[model samples]
Target: MEKNAIVDLVRSKAEGYFERGEFFCSESVVHTINELLGWPYSEDVVRMASGFPIGMGKSGCLCGAVSGGSMALGMAYGRKHGEPMNEKMFPIAKELHDYIKSLYGSTCCRVLVRNYEFASPERKAHCVKITGEVAAWIASKLLDDPEISQKINPNFK
Candidate 1:
């Protein structure tokens, strides 16, 4: 079956960014979204998602696409963890998760689908599709207006 049009749109966007060495999960998300929408590439996206440390090595510890989308959301709306969510975060997080998981099943890095680290498939088309679409959906929703990034964690700022 063919995928949703919007989902596919975002997926394609994510893939283009991935091709450009935007490998880190969280920052790659911003790169994917912006590049998809014709926005300029910037290092700040990488700087922000890297705030939490991303040593997962593409092992699927947490789905890179999911982590990327989550980071994108955080970058646009402020961080969601380490404090009481101010009424808009929890639902948004769940909603985002539901959107991606419904399409891809599980979001666990290694479980829903294997990671590149495992060499599961060379240029795995389906995995790329899932990750890309997930990132696009996140950008379409959370970053629809394209706000500037803020320090998600104060100490990290």
Candidate 2:
């Protein structure tokens, strides 16, 4: 499949997972990216993203999708113990943060969904959209950058 096609698929799956209540925002992004990257981490890897939902467990701080996207970036670029940090990690993560911030003015989940009731369909749909968008954005970053793609998953194509 074409790279864009793959990105779209990732977005759809991430959205579906959240829309179906299978996972929250951060978990959806982490799960989708981890799966797409061919399970570089174990299945238990998603556990780390569990607490980020509802803006850090309803504290309403960072957007959960953004947090998950950062985790996905780490999966791609983070270094192992004793290895120097990957040079591209910070810039790529900043790009994800800036991308969402530019679109919504804030990465705060409370701020983004403030107009809708927390339990309302509107809020869920809004979060679902953000989740999918972030997943697709990360998918594109993973696929388009040959250097990063090769490093993370040489068999991605």
lDDT per model, in order?
0.55, 0.91
What TM-scores do the predictions have? 0.61, 0.94
Off by over 4 Å in 1: 1-10, 20-25, 34-42, 48-55, 79-86, 114-117, 120-123, 143-157
Best by TM-score: 2
Which residue pairs clash within candidate 1?
11-132, 11-133, 60-109, 60-110
What is the Cα-based lDDT of residue 54 in candidate 2?
Answer: 92
lDDT tens per residue, model 1, 1-157 = 1124544556665665555555544555666555443443365556655532132554446666666677565545555469665565566667788887787677675666544544444534555665677676764564334342221122210
lDDT of 2 by residue, 1-157 (tens): 7777888889999999999999999999999999888888997898999999999988999999999999999998899999999999999999999999998888999999999999999999999999999999999998888866664443443
User: Which candidate number has the best lDDT?
Assistant: 2
